[model samples]
Target: MKDAWIPYATRAVPRYTSYPTAADFTPETGVAAAMAWSAATRADEAISAYLHIPFCDKLCWYCGCATSVPNGYRRVAEYVGLLLKEVSLRGRAMGPHGGIGHLHFGGGSPNILNPNDFLELMDALQRHFGLRTGAEIAVELDPRTMKPGQVPTFARAGVNRVSLGVQTLAEDVQHAINRIQPRDMVVALIEDLRGAGIDAVNMDLMYGLPYQTTQHVVEAARFAAEMGAARVSVFGYAHVPWFAKHQRAIDENALAGLHERFTQARVAAMTLEGAGYVAIGLDHYARADDTLAIAAREGRLHRNFQGYTDDPCETLIGMGATAISQFREGFSQNLKDRKAWGEAVTAGHLPAERGIALTPDDRLRARALETLMCRLEVDAAEICAEMDVPDDRLDGALDAARELERVGLCHVSGTVVTVPEEARIMLRTVAQCFDARSPAAAPQRHAKAV
Candidate 1:
């Protein structure tokens, strides 16, 4: 049955993190738009914050992020200083928001920061944004490089959740990806984090890496379960060497075929489910008591640049180099180049380089795409009615959905488009039916639909 999903996996499609996707962002919509959106944020509206730390001790060959390995702690410390300055700049930009309900720290190993730096950064954020009473402070950690005092520092700073990047436990697999961390190291990190009162631990696992196999995938999944991970994200490695030059280090021949990749993913899913985890949207799974699982069950799941999330805030302010922020009106990105970002921030300017504003049509299509991506289905009439879109306006999308129906990717019964459970992995191709801009040209930038 898993092999049956092979043919459809060959099609390239966007992950649908956003309707138009990041490939469509242009320089014309820059810092001005971002500033306007930030200023317009209602005082009573809850906000989500994402802080990027773009430094790592070692560069993973398969990494597809805007990050680099710093030569020493001096560079990382320097970045933190700049980040503090940027936080103050952003705090002034937004001005007295109600409170921050969600704060996420992501990047090239956020755990690499010294304990003092991490706590200072948290204090700066808390002072500026006013952390809500029960806000969730989530940080992505690279367990391999976590310092001794980091966990306690996180707990002291009110960190509630920690996501560890444990891509795989096999020595050969880790070596191939140039991220060598053993299973014991990960277990120790989890234990330490748990001991420090951070009970919610999320582990990331990968299936489609070069030299990865079904056995390796299962092993990683079982290990995550054994370590009592509250949530697990299993992702297929998208080999886009052209986009991520470091990926070229991977041997093309060592990569699995589409069928094998599907099998590997299924094996991991089965292993996790057997260990009592409920599958969340797409590639995430959570324990029954986890907030993510509750979100999935209640149909309150959301798709963000970071993938599946339980955060319900309409606005997300992303700070630091290469961070992307989402506002009620649009999406904007900071400069990807570190030097340019630092220079712009130093000059008392937002470091935005590109962005896209949402038109009425864009917002409507975005709602529909997000619904499909989160729920694996969308009622075209229902959503259009809510958005007050005319029936004739969505004719092109209806036609596209009908065409997809013929391909067995979706079933359009009246106006409700549903992707069967078996075809859930290819749901992005189904949701792409609603995209109006360059749908034909989408393939050039998309990862695989499956």
Candidate 2:
């Protein structure tokens, strides 16, 4: 499977993080829909939030996030001020619902904010949407920029989990990607975070990077294990220069080919498993005792825009420029332009620019796709029954899977499609079969399956 899969490896597919993915969002559904949906949060539901900090001190060429290098702190301060207003606006729009169960700070680097600024934002979130008792607060950290005092400050604000961006440990690979952080920098930061009561340390590692080899991938995975990382996410670097222009800075010639990338992903998974970590879903590996691993084992695992998660919240308030919000009705995204986002927030309006309202068909297919992506298998018949649709509703997808099975992509036992372990890297390829959004017609919109 490893050597024979190269032809399909480079074929692009949506991450299936969301059904109808972001590519299907349209301007037809804008702020009014956002407002109506936001106000409809279930009274008994415990919601989640994603606060996007679109500022980073430095730009990493390999990064493909909605962020920029703010030359000065002035822009960041202004962004945060508006973000707080947006939070209040969102909270009020979502009147009288259960409190927050999961709060995530993601960005170019969420830790780019000063300690005081971080605290101020936390306070605003608490005031607006109270964090339910033991609610998970997770932050994505940049080890090189993390200050000594920020660790404890994060803990003080109830940040119990952190994910350090440790893409590669090899000096050459680090130089190639332009995200330089010594291994010791990450080690020290982890130790400090642990000392500050932030014990759920998740390390994000990457394969398929420029100048990266299987050895480089293995060393990073091993380092995550040695440093006691509770969760390690091994991501395949997606080089989408057309989408993320900074990627043009990387030397495309130096990037690993599909075969080599497949090898690196395999090696990284093997190394993490060798260290007693359980592979959760496609790329995440967690200690056997970690909540994420336990969730995967107990069938409580879920996938979101943030990848594999234990978060079961139905409503996610996305606050910031280019942030995408999730609700039972559908999805909405804040304005991608900072000036536009700020103006909307300042005018006391929902900042939603574009989105897609979920159709019943979309939701049914979404459940099937997420189930397959999370568990590597899905009984389409069972899903259709659960969604109150006909068992034959997904006959087209089963036929698609049959075509893939001829090429060894999946096994279709009646309506149950199963992706073999060897096909895990191409999980999206199998999952995309259920995507009703015409994924194959928009190949360049997403990354390669590998």
Candidate 3:
């Protein structure tokens, strides 16, 4: 890594997964906004739904997800009931849509539910939302907590894709993060899922762990390839103890330094690319034939709260606590507190507690940011024209990009701004230039750009 880039890489920046970001959400735009947005969905357009299961058997120290350990099944069962009711309410609020084209189950771990309970939830989703024929159902799983018969049950329920949380293979690093699934365990789970006919496997690998080395990161990427993972996401472990209390259990001193973290990221990227996985966006790698790779190749890729996806649904309805829903109007989040979320749903209301209404400018900037983040380049003039706004509306952003250009972070040619291949890792910094709502100075509020 160049010393000149260190200052840029170390600075905090929005991931730009969503323009205006979650930082802009507030109580002023709550349930009413969410209700209106859902009600306003065009009947002819297919939509996406996200179900968040915020319960896990074990809390990994390095996890930043909104999940907790349920000492007993009663809590999970109770939560599932509320989740189903919430689904019904949201479905009714949405009125009639083309049907659900994409369904996603995420969490602390969706596998935490009992197999029967999991199937019931899936049934409820289909019953209420009218799951479109041949729609994609994707779920995130923790191999450590995967019970017997779960794989078969998931296949029976029509789950087509499974993302496994296989953050690291090193025993020392796993122990440090309080997640100790062996490499063999993960490999066996993958084989079992494939045997049951759910072959679209996505493995998640991490780089900046408490005791992770560049070799550890590289070996993990290699293992994912060897397992025939359809996609692999290499993420830098964010150490935000204040945001995720469980992360405080990790020793900060044991984490890799900035340069080491940068090297580990590069090594993992090289390993995945060398293994024939096409790099998709910032941190995702996919086999050349995978849908995500195809999306990137054809420019159909999209970024959402769930990271990169090929789902083209315009409306993403998020169910359960802390899940964020994206609509044409803006973004809405269910209450983060489980009790509050349950109460709202029990009262026959949407659980949305805070959100932001997207202004025309917000939409325009979002399009430009999404374009740059997904394609590594954006034609500002084209975006403005597409948004039916004058090209001068983006002059401020283009000027900002010009400043970054002088630093070798990006190139500004006419109304087009492109992040160079070498500066791809700093993509967020370049995208941040177009964010009108970003705070001037609050490094602690976001993860470093790298």
- By descending lDDT, how would the candidates be arranged? 3, 2, 1
Per-residue lDDT of candidate 1, residues 1-450 (tens digit): 344445556767778887667888899999999889889888788899999998888899888877888988999999999999899899888844688999999998898899999989989998887899899999999988988888899999999999999988888888899998987888888888889999999999998888888898998999989888999998889888888898999988999887787778788888999999998767888999999989989989999988889888889999999899999889999999999999999999999999899899988888889998888888888888999988566667878988877768789888888888767667777777888875654454867864
lDDT of each: 0.86, 0.91, 0.91
Indicate the TM-score of model 3.
Answer: 0.98
Total clashing pairs for each candidate: 0, 0, 0
- RMSD in angstroms, candidate 1? 1.6
| Residue-by-residue lDDT tens digits, candidate 3, 360-415 | 99999999999999999999999999999998999999999988888899999999
Would you give me the overall lDDT of model 2? 0.91
Q: Write the per-residue lDDT of candidate 2 for residues 260-290, one digit (tens) a residue.
A: 8888999999999999999888899999999
Give me the displacement of residue 281 in model 3, in angstroms: 1.1
TM agreement with the true structure for every prediction: 0.97, 0.98, 0.98
